[model samples]
Target: MQEILRKGLEEMIMKEALKKVLPLVGSVAMLAACGNGGNKANKEAGKTDHNGVAKFNMKVEHEGKPIKGGELRYALVSDDPIKGLFNPALCQDQSDQDVVNFMFDDIFIVDSNNHLTNDGLAKYKVDKDARTVTVTFPKGAKWSDGQPLTVDDYIFTHEFIANKDYPGVRYPSSVGPLVGAEEYHSGKAANISGIEKKDDQTVVLHYKQMNPSIEISGGDLLSYVIPKHVYENIPMNKVMSHDASRKNVVGNGPFKIESLIPGESVTLVANENFYKGRPKVDKITIDVVSSKNIISEMKNGNYDIAGMPADQYDAYKDAANFSVIGKPAYSYSYIGFKLGKWSNEKGANVMDPNAKMNNKKLRQAMAYALDNDQIAKKFYKGTRFSANSLIPPVFKEYNKDTPEYNYNPKKAKKLLDEAGYKDKDGDGFREDPNGKPLVIKYATMAGGQNDQTLALAYVQFWEKIGLKVELTTGRPIEFQAFYDKVEHDDPEIDVYSAAWGTGTDPDPSGLYGEHEKFNMTRYVSDEHTALLKDISSDKSFDEAHRKAAFDKWQNFAHEEAFAIPTLYRTGITAVNKRVKYYDLVSGSEDTKARLYNLQLTQSKPVGE
Candidate 1:
C-alpha cells in the first residue's frame, strides 16, 4: 500500500512539473482603542503579536451581565447571500462560509500569539522524514446528532474531495501533493493509499514530502469531517443540491443550523451535543441587508451588530449607544482580469483565444493609473491603506520586491501609447491595435453604494489615461449570482473588483493556483505554478529555500501585472449597547465577530 502511494506521488509530481513549464496564470482577541473621535478611529491600528503579523482583536462591553435566551440579529451586508450547499465541500463564498463556521471546526486554529493550536483536534503528530501526519479524535467526540465522530468521518472527507466526480475547487492548491491524490482524483484508483483508518478513533495521512504548510494548509486544517453513513450514497454531481448538504448537515461545532433561508437568512441554535459547552447564546439569526440599507437598519435597531461602513463611521463612533471598533484584518481588496479557460475533461488551464484581457501592457497601464492611496483616504477614512501586493505587507514572507503601482497618469498614457492604443477615430477614448474601440467591462457586486462609489473612482482614473469604460451598474445582482458569473468565466466581464479575507496560513494558492476553483483571477503561467509549488510544498524543508521561493513568486506575479492590489482593510464592527459578549477574541483568522459568544444585557434598555 505504501509503495503504491509512493508511485502515485512520483507520477503526479512529474505531471505537475511539466505543467509548470507551460504558460497561464479573521479571528481575534480583544484589546481596545475604543469609543470615538475622528482621529481616534483612524488610529485603531491592529496590535501585533511576536511574529510581526498584525493581530485582529475582538472587544465589546455591556453594563448588564450575561444571560442566555435572546436572539442576536445581524444584518448581512450583501444583496445575494448564501445559496444552500452548506457542506464544507461546496461552500466557497464568504456568505456561505460565515454560516459554515458555526457548524464545522477546522483542524487547527491560530492562537492569540499567531501559532496553530488544535482547537477541535485531540492529538496530532507530524513525522517530517516520513512525510506523514497521524491524528486522533477525542474518544468521546460527538456530532450534533449524538453519534461518535470517528476516524472514518475524517478519512472520508479526503476521499470525497479526491473523487473526480466531486465538483468542489479547494483541494488542488490547498492540499499539495498528497500520496495517491492524483490517481484518486483521476479515478484511476478506488481509494487513496496514503490514508489509513487505523482504528475507529484515529486516522493517518501520508504526503509526497514534508512542508511547513501541512500544519495549516494541508488537508488537516482544511478537512470537514463527513458522516460516511449519510454521504456515501449521495451522487457526487448532485451533492450540491443534496438535501443533506442544504438542510441537514451535521457537525461537531458548538452551534448547528436550525434553519437556513437560502439567500434570505440563517437561523442557528446552540448545539447541546457540542464538545465545547453549548454556546452562551440560545439563538442567532443572520439576515441579509443590502449594502445601501445597512445604515438605516442599524439606526432602526434591526441589527444587533454588523460591519459599520466607513462613511457611516463618524455618525456612530461617538454615539454613546454604539460600540464602533476597528482592528487590522488580514485581507486585501483588488481587481483581476480573466486570463485563461478551464477544460473539465482535459483539466487544462490554457490561454483563451477570445480573452479580452490578453494584453499585459494594457493591464500594466491600468495598474499604473490606479491611485490606491487616494481612494483609501477618500473612501475608507482611516479604515484602510494602500496595498502594493495581493499578499499584504503584514505577512513575514511578504516579498520586498513587490512592485508598487502608485498613481502616475503620464506613465499610464505612455504605456498605452507604446502599446498602440491610440485615438485613431478622433474620439477621447483610445483604440486597440486593430482600431477597435478599447473598452473595459468592469463587474462588481451590487448591494452597496460603496461598490459603485469605488467603481466610479476607478473609471475616472482609467478614463484620465484615455480608456473607455462600461461599468456593471444598471442592475445589481446578489452576491451569489455575481460570483457565479465571475467564477464560471462570464464572457461579459473584462475585470472584477474583489476582496479576500485570508487564513492564518500564509500560502494563498487556493486563490491563485490554476487548478483552484477560487482562482477567479484566471491567471495562468508555468512560472507561477513552479514558484507556488516551491514555496508551498517545497521538496526541501529548509526555511531559507522556502522564503526565496515565496519572494520569487510574489515579484513574478506583480511584474506581470496579474492583478491590481488596492488596499489592506481595517475590520469595523459596531454593536448596539444591549449586545453583550460580541466575541471571545481568539485566533486572528477569518471569522464573523462571533454571534455565538453574544448574550443580551438584562440591565440595558432596548436600543440603549
Candidate 2:
C-alpha cells in the first residue's frame, strides 16, 4: 500500500513538472491524462492515458458485509435556497432527485455500466414484436402505509402524469410508446388506453410504436406508483404540494422518512418491512451544504460522504482512510444559445424570426472562441476534459472524430467577419449583422465564489472576439427560479450556462427531442427528430445501424451550434475509509451513488 501511494504521488509531481517545462499546447495535453483519483478505496483502480481520457476499471468494491444501525451523513450542492416540497414526478433539481430516490424506488436498478436490473417489479419481460412490456408485482410488496401495491397504483401513476392540470412535467417521453399517453395529456382521451391491468398483481403496457428502451424506462413507471391510497383523496393538481410528498412521505423502499426540515436536512430510518429486505444501514442523514463548503465539511468530518470538488482532489485523494472515487460521469454541461422564444407556460420555444441569436454562425463563433483547455486545468483541475459534442465520450456511440471548436480565437474572428458581424464602429466590440451594437444576455445559476469566477472566465473568452455579453439575472438566481427561467424560456435569457448529466443508454433524444421539457434551448428539426427516434423509441434491432444514426446526429448537432458543449467530466466523491459499499456515477439514473447497499465497517472479505 505504501509503495502504491508513493507511485501515485510521483505521478502527480511529474505531471506538474511537465506542465511548467512545456509550452501552452503541450501543457493542456499533460493535464488531461495524469490521475489515479477514481479508485475504490484503492482496492482496484482506473487509469488515464496520454490525452487525459480516464479509463475506469469498475471492479465492484466493499460489499456482502455490513455493520448495521449507523447513520450516514451526506452533503449536497444546490443553486436554489432549497424550500420546495419533494414530489418524485415533479422533481426539477439534483437535491430533490437524490432525496426522492430514498423515498421512492427507481423502479429499475441501473448499474454503474448502464446494465439495468429489475428492482421494484417482481417480474419484467419484453416482446420486441409486440413492442410491449409485461410487469408483475409480488403479493408481499406493500406501500409504507401497508397498502398493497397493485395495478391501480401503476395505472394511477400513468394517469397522474397525463393529467394536464398536474404541474412539473416528467412524462409523455417516458410514455412515448404508450398508446394514448400523449392523447390523454393533450386532453384528447379520457384514459391511457395502452395500460392494461390484467389482474390485481399483473399489468401489461402496450407501446404505440417500437421501443427498445422499455427495460430502463421502467423508472418512469416507478415515478407514478405513488401510494394511491395516500394521494387518492387529494386533487391531482395539488398532490405535488401535499405533505405526503415531503413532510409525511411514505415509500416502500428500504428507508422511511424520519424527519424533514427543508433546505436544512432530512433523516431517514431503515424500513423493516422493505420487500427487498431491510437495508444494512440503520439511518441516512442528508445535509444540504453549500458546494463551497463541501471540501471543508469533509475534512472536518461533518460530511461522511460528499461530492469531491475537483479543485480539492489533491487534499484528500491520498489522505489516510479516504478514497477519491472517479468515473466517466453520465452527463454533459454546456452553454445554450436561445435560437427560439420559450413563448408558452408549458416551456415551449417558438422559433422567432426577429430573435438576434437566430444566427447559427455567431453561436458557432462563440463556440470556437472558448479556451476549454484553460477551464479544464484551472476550473476542473484535471478531473474534466473539454467536450466537442454533447454526447459523452464514455458512451459507445460517442464519435471521437466529431467536428471540433478547439479554442481558436483567430478562426472565431474569421467566422464572425464572414457572418457579417464586424466592428463597423470604433468601439472594440462587434455589432449585429445589421451593424447595431450587440449585447448578448448570458444567464447562469447563482452559485458561490467559484461559480462567479467560472462565469467570468466564460465572459472573458467571448469578449476576446469582440462579443459583448451581460449577466442575465441580476444576482446568482436561486435553483428553482434559474431552471424556471431556462426551461420556461424567458426571452431575457439568450445564452444560458448549464450542465446535464446523461442517462443509462447513450440516448440524447430525451434532452434534444421536440417534446422534452429539459430542452432549454428548444432546438428542434425534422432531421433531429428522425435521428433521435431511430436510436431509442423507433430503433432498429441492428446495432450498427443505430450507431451510424447516432454518429450522424452528433456531427449535425455540433455543426448547428445551438449549444456549445463545454466539458465532459468525471465525478469525484471522497468516501471516508469507514464508509464502504458505495461509488459515484453520472448519467440517466443515480446508480453510481446507490446508498441503500452502503455499509459502514472496517473489515471485509477478499476481493470486496
Candidate 3:
C-alpha cells in the first residue's frame, strides 16, 4: 500500500531546485488572472432590469470588412498584478486565466448547454457500463513547439496534479474520481493504474464509478492537456516556475507566448501550426491594467478590448468609442465564516462544534444585516445584483429561487436576541451567547474604486445589527495576500468576502466538498456531504433527482449560513469599434469568435 512513497524519494531531494529557480509565492503571483468569450451579432446594447442587472445581448454584429492582419491590444482589468503560473493545470487565478485562455485550449469543447461536444482538439466517448472515458486526439494536432500532442500528455496532466509533491489546489476534486488516484496521491501506489494509454493519441480513464459530472469540463476528466515532453523530467514542485511554464511556455492553442514581462504584461504571436488554423492577428498583447483605469484607457483607444469593472460601468456604458458587451457570468461573491480548520493529515475539513462563529443564529443575523441590494445599485449601477444562492442563475437548469436573506435589520436583531448575543458590556455591539464580548474579524480583497467603500459598508451593516465586525490586518488585503491568508486559515480572519469562478459543470463539489482545499471556509456537515454526492451520483442521471439535490443543498447551505451569497456578476467587456470580431458569450459553440477567426477592421483600436 505504501510502495508509492519509495518511488519518489529521489524527487524529494530535487524539491529544493524550485527555490533556486523562483520563489514559490512570487512564482504563483506571476500566474493568476481571468478570461471571457463573446458573440458577434446584436449591435444594440441591453436593457436594465428591476434588479439593476442589465441583460446584454449574447450575440453582437459589427459592420466592417475584416482586414488581412493586425495586432490585438487586450487589457486584463485588475488592480492586482499577474502571477505568472501560465500552465493550465497550475493557473487558477482569474487574472492569470485571462492570459492562459489566449495560449491554451481545453481538451474538450463545452457548449452553452454545459455539455461536452466533439468540436475540440479531441473527441470523447463515455461508457457507463465500463466506468471508463476514452479520449481520442486526431493525428495532426501539434503543440506550438512543433511537438506531437500525444495521449501521454493527457495522462501526464493527471499524474502531475495527483503527485503527492504537487502543490496546487486542484488535487482533491479534480482527479479524485480516477481509480487509484487516492492511492497514488497518498503514496500508496507507484503510479495511477487507471490512466491507460492505448496508443499515441488515445487514452482511457477508468473511474471507480462514472457519474453525470463527467458530462462537463469540471468533472474528473483533465480539461487541458500539458506537453509531457516539456515537464516529465522536472521536479513536481519546480514545474510551476520552470521556464516551460513561464517564459518559454508552449501550447496547441491559437497563440504562442512571444514575450512575457512577469507580473505586468504578455505578448503572444500567432501559432502557425494551430489545429484551428493560424490566428488571424499577427500578434496579441495582454496588459494588466488597474480596474480603475480601464474606462479611461478604453476611451483613449489604448485597448482593443478590456474587462470593464462593474463599478465603472456607468462611466463606460455610453462611451461612443467602445460598446459595453456583457453576459451573466458563472460566478458569485459571498461572505464565508470560518467554522473549522482543515486537517491536512486527514485531507478533510474538521468542523469544530464550538467555534466562535459556530452559532447558526449569529451567522443568519449577519446575513440578514447585509444590504447587498443597495451595494448593487449604488456601486455596480446596473451590472450586478444580489445573489440568492451559491449556484448562480447562469446554471438555469439547476439554480432555483430558494429562500435568501434580504436586508432585514428587524429580523437580524430578533435572531441575535433569540441567540442570546446582546450588548452585555453596555456597548452598542453585541456580546456572545455566554455574555462575553464578541468581535468578528473580516477580510476582503483590495481592488477597484468601491472596494474599500463596499467593505466599510458591510462593516456598518453588521454594526447596525449590533455585531462588531472589523477588517483583518486593519484594511483590505491585496489579491494574492488576501487568498494566502484565507487559504491558510489566518487566525485573525473569522469571516471573508470573495468571489468564485465556476466551471462549465454545475457541480459545487470542487468548491464546497469536504476534501476540497478550495473550500476556504473549512465547513463540513453530514447533510452537506450527502447532498454533494447526490448531485454527482449516478442517480443524478435523472434530471428531476439532480435538480432536487441542488435545490436541497442551496436551502441547506443557506439555512446553515456558513456561506452567504452576496452578488452575481454581469461580466462586462468594453470592445473598441475597430475590432471586427470578439465574443463575450462564455462557453458558446460558435468558433467564429475564437482567436483564430478574430479580425480587425483597422490597424489599431479607434475611439469614436
> For each candidate, how many residue pairs have backbone atoms clashing (under 3 Å)?
16, 15, 28
lDDT (0 to 1) per candidate: 0.64, 0.64, 0.75
User: lDDT of candidate 1?
Assistant: 0.64
Tens-digit per-residue lDDT, 1-608, candidate 1: 22322332122111000100101111211211111122232233333344332333346555666565777676655545446557766666555555666677654545454555565455677888787888888787788889877888877887887788777765554343678888888889888888877888777778876667666532234445667777889998888888888888787666788887777888888899876567776877878775556666776667676665554444555555555555565567777887876668666556675677788888889888887775555444455677877776667777757878888889999998999999998879999988997778888665543344545556777888899878764444445566678778787788877777665456767668777666777778888887877875655257788778778877887788767777776667766667654543445342323334456765332453
lDDT of 1 at 186: 89
Task: Give the per-residue lDDT digits (tens) of candidate 2, residues 1-608.
Answer: 22322232222211111111111011011101112123345542234578755444322244333465577776654434455456566665555656666767645555435444565445667777886778787776877667777778777777776677667556555664588887887789988888888998788888877655455433233333667787768886677777777688877666788886777888888877777677777887877776566656666666566555554555555554455566666566688888765444653545666777888889899998887765665444467789888888877889998987898989999999999999888798999889888999888766555455555556777888999987887554555676778776787888987777555456677677677666768777778788877776455457788788888889989988888888777666556556654544422244323445566664321111
Error of 1 at 284 (Å): 1.8
Alpha-carbon shift of residue 596 in model 3 (angstroms): 1.3
Residues 218-330 of candidate 3 have per-residue lDDT tens digits of 66667688888988899987887788888899887889888888899999999988888887889989998876677788999999877666655556677877766766776
Best by lDDT: 3
Ranking by TM-score: 3, 2, 1
TM-score of each: 0.85, 0.86, 0.91
Candidate of highest TM-score: 3
Q: Residue 411, candidate 2: how far off, in angstroms? A: 1.2
